[model samples]
Target: MLNIADTLHRWCREERPFALATVVKVRGSAPLPVGTSVAVDEDGNAVGSISGGCVEGAVYELCRQVLDDRGAPQRARFGYSDDDAFAVGLTCGGELDVLVQRVDPGTRPYLATALADVVEGRPAAVAQVVEGPEELLGGMLCVDAAGGIRHGPLTGVLRREVGAQAWSLLRAGRTARAEVGGDAETCPERLSVLVHVHASRPRMLIFGAVDFAAALSQAGRFLGYQVTVCDARPVFATAARFPHADEIVVDWPHRYLEQAEVDTRTAVCVLTHDAKFDIPLLRLALGLPVGYVGAMGSRRTHDERLRLLSEAGVPEGQLARLRSPIGLDLGARTPEETAISITAEIVSRTNRATGLPLSALAGPIHAGTSS
Candidate 1:
């Protein structure tokens, strides 16, 4: 499958006409979650994003003109680091780069197919940006869930194998990078693939629409989760309350879990303190392949919940999957702080980490650069 970059290239070649936006660099806290992308078509149409509505407008204009000129791919950059952003009228003041190119239909047939596949739920594609002009720009592999590697302008058996590994990652809804070992004596530098895994955007199913849930949804969005909030009361589940949430469902907690698709990449968090809502939801959450299942309460509440579940025929082994007292022991007192603790726990699970502080631990936080 064609990675996002290659897909744009291929589409442009086909004369379909699209824009390409890329995160070139990030500094400080950063507005855009890096690797965020946005594109536009010839008729001032767009898909994806570069920043939080900051530079996307100007970038789209460039794309509109660039689509008409298929001479060569052009790279456009915007950033807070530059004095130029004020002139462009970007409020967020974040840094971004956009590549506007006309795609080749014949050469990028695979990319076009991959783009279609993603929209149709054929699974994501992994792509490798190898031998590019700069450091972060080169040898980069972006793997979709299925692990198919999209290697650009690079060829050989290694490319095939690595691309296949990328494909596997894409299909699996995981991200990974592969480095080719064998190289000729003349070519000393082994192919170093900077693997960037793009799984299906994680689903954050939040079971409460309380104040805490808003912060929790924001935290989840920061982690790239497609956030959703559930509250049986329609009054609470309004767009005004959860501005960050991608979705808000007013339905029974357990029913929502049963009806909505839950997968391994999904996370379910129960913020409601009420036993009436949480217990049923917990039962449903434990049954799925979801990566994380957490419920908010105290140690006493946790014990009581366990006792109730035991009475309901849930075994101890199954009950162990529930994070009853929910969140790491971060000594968080407020809803926002508590939200951070919960999200931290989710990251621990995602990275398969032990949830220890860097001061207490040693070695790299990231497990491997390429896998």
Candidate 2:
């Protein structure tokens, strides 16, 4: 799994055989999402986690069994049990369908190639046959960012179909499952393939090196963002001040952002409250195709900011995209609390969530994904 890519890559380099248990499907409120995995080395050591703590012991034992059985692949289903309180299952009342497969460099060469791509920050995806014919059970297909198949077993139309799906998943940076085959040329029956997307972490560009920015940088990094704190003042934007930031750039915020490679997955936070710094940076960030563009200020400052940007020729629609208050209404006053609120808003906007508590909703607790 990409979450533990570094550990897995290390194991591969050592030529150590291990069993990987990945959550391929979930039926209900799972704490962790699909593609979360737990790996166990041949020496009875383990790394990574499937569930936060719910069914790890069971999955670890499953990994041990796979190693003892000489790298045989297996499937396991875990759910809450009403009969036995000590049963190995999820306490959150969810079901996890786990696929345990052995990764041996001598046999599965594609595992190494896929893990290498992930560790090196190259966009890639590994399509594993989760449910299908007996012989094709644990087959894997590795696809790169350019829709090129680095390794796989399927050929002809089936290979093309799987490769296309893998490319789609990689572009979206999502780990999902798709059904392929069920044709004369491909396969008579439908086969389910779990595409484990290994995309680089998205970028979180925070302008202004204030205390709030420092707290936000730490929160963004925890949320899996490659955070960069940029400012025009070199005195404030130092590594010692923002130790959690991946990068600290002492440049004009707008000038630095003009050349940044931003995409729909990037989040641009304008924390500089000054009129000179805020106006130009927001003018550019608002027009760009980014996931979120938020600014920090009071109600009066927010109104003035909107007027300035409107006068600067920014469209009304684009101005609406700016989250002037920068965070949800969490009544937060401290820097750390504000950081939590800001990152919460970013996640809610990214996931298209309602920002409402689960108690107010009636459906599934966790968001649904293709499986």
- Using TM-score as the measure, the top candidate is 2
Per-residue lDDT over 255-302 for candidate 1, one digit per residue giving the tens place of the 0 to 100 score:
889989777778899988788998788877887788899999889998
Give the alpha carbon lDDT tens digit for every residue of 1-371 in model 2. Answer: 77798888888888998888999899878889988889999998999988899999889998999888874589999999999989988888888999998878667677788889898989889998889987787788889878889766777788888888999989888888889988887889889998999887899999999999999999999999999999999999999999999999999999999999888899999888899999999999999999999999999999999999999999999998998789999999998999999999999999888999889997668756424
Model 2: residues with Cα > 4 Å off, grouped in runs: 14-16, 41-45, 64-72, 120-122, 145-147, 184-188, 369-371
Could you estimate the TM-score for every candidate?
A: 0.60, 0.86
TM-score of candidate 2 versus the correct structure, residues matched by position? 0.86
Collision count for each candidate, in order = 34, 0
- The list of candidate 1 runs beyond 4 A from truth reads 1-109, 112-123, 127-167, 177-197
Clashing residue pairs, backbone N/CA/C < 3 A, model 2: none
